[model samples]
Target: MRRRFWLLLPLLSLAGALQAQAPLDLPQQAASAQPAEAADYQVLDFDWQDKSRQREVPVRLYWPAQAASAAVPLVVFSHGLGGSRQGYSYLGRYWASQGYASLHVQHVGSDRRIWTGNVFSLIGRLQDAAKESEALDRVRDMRFALDRLLAAEQGAHIDRQRIVAAGHSYGATTSLLLAGARPPDAPAGLQDERIRAAIIISAPPFYGQGAPEPILAPVRVPTLHVTATEDVINVPGYHSEAGDRLSVFEATGGQRKRLAVFTGGSHSIFTDRAGTGGVTLNPQVKAATRELTLAFLSSVFEGREEGLQSWHQRWKPLLARWQ
Candidate 1:
């Protein structure tokens, strides 16, 4: 009973972290209508294997319905811990509508099974050294997925130069690895040169080892960091404060780095179907994130800075803290 009580307490804190939409006294300007809606998009599901890693990664691909003038840009998504490729459909769907391919890849180890075994199992694995090495494994999954996708028949429709790595939470860490964020413990040659840019959603600070700045020094690619002021992920043995996300944004050395810190959102906002409550569902937060991320990708993927400029001009007021 005590153990269960301790576990549920964090979940309650997480629930309580979500605040109601702004009150009448605290008025907020709505964001510019980000082209969040994708045009028509097609979804395909497949299980791909990496013989070197001896793992089969489940992937859900979302691409523009109509053929493009040239190959469409692709963003490979890695979901948060215990989350499947299907987790953040909002990002996948929105990007696809805008004529980009969004591929969500699932890492088998340290995945959904961790949460399903018991309510507390997921939290337990966070500090489990045996399970700690899985982050590197997840990085391998991203590289292998890219190798296979760019070689498949469908590869003909993807713009090889515009591939971006994106993820939230632990998945965000995986994307960072691909973008050149190296943990001292991770093996050499894990970073991929093909990932031209990256979107890091709720990336945690490199805790206890050293300063997050030096740890993230290797990630010099164009990057975007997305998180909420109240964003906190409380696992059993670890502490994830909003500062964790902020540290990554502040420390990154990317020449074109951007941070979108929204007001009153929680860790759950990154997922499509899951909402912690009112704050995660706030229209202002949602609109700004969707539009800002789209604009960032637009700038990096299409080699056009217009969308990003429009974002700065129109959505600046809604963003609580940004650079």
Candidate 2:
């Protein structure tokens, strides 16, 4: 069992490198909607040290320049494997502009540093990043970052009850673990009760694990799953179909869950990369994704489903499924 798990690590860690080979035939829009500019929010960088684990957790916090009278909502984001704190600036800026604090946590062990060094050793690095130890450390990085954030001066402005966990690909797996996923032989105390909702983008399955239902049944938080029909992960010996995302959504235990499947896009389209998916559709999907996240947040925090309905109406043409 351990050997089989080791063999699947490459497929798990390299999920962000999904190739977008699907042909996009959607009607062209006159112009893609742009996210708010960086000037709208205040960006703060932090390099925190976890003395116990001897790990470095780097993070970027995007706070709204225009403060609200009451505490503001917060979204803690985890990036995909091989991504960094700066990878998803679009979502951070947008969320901050709309009165929510966005905290992006970077896990060093599985981050972009693995892409450096000898090209011949790339596979080895990916395997190491996907090891169970590093995966657990990613979760610890998030929890530790949250603790540090809440203790900081700006933490006073954050609305603790409105906190959400979000991520893409491998990071999505992290989000699920925080949302209460229980893999076999995993340790206890993985879930953080502070996360009221979650936004999972292009989530990969728990490889070498038996059935997804048992593994994902503990994720009871309100979840919004975002994926595309072409979000396929193709490694040398393993392949993860876009349908896996749907299966996860189905198995995830939540009565208030929602899913939005774009017609055609690569898994990497959600990242900062603008060209992995169709150039015309990439920005469109990103814009829609950010807006969808905000709508999901509104529904979770403010109990407002109107924004979600409105978003569905506006972006229906780009969607293969929404529910």
Q: Backbone collision count in every prediction? A: 2, 0
Instruction: State model 2's lDDT.
Output: 0.84
CA lDDT of every candidate:
0.71, 0.84
- Candidate with top lDDT is 2
Q: What count of clashes does model 2 give?
A: 0
Cα lDDT tens digits, model 2, 151-201, are: 998888888898899998888889999999988767899999999999999
In the range 1-323, model 1's lDDT, one tens digit per residue, is 21121111121123224567643222244322233454588888989998877888889998788635568888999887667877777677778887789999998875566556666654565333124456667888888888888887678889888889998877777788899876665568877998889999877666544677776888988999998877877654545678778888888877889888876677766665333535324555555666678888777766778887877667665456877
TM-score of every model versus the real structure: 0.85, 0.92
Against the correct fold, how does model 2 do in TM-score? 0.92
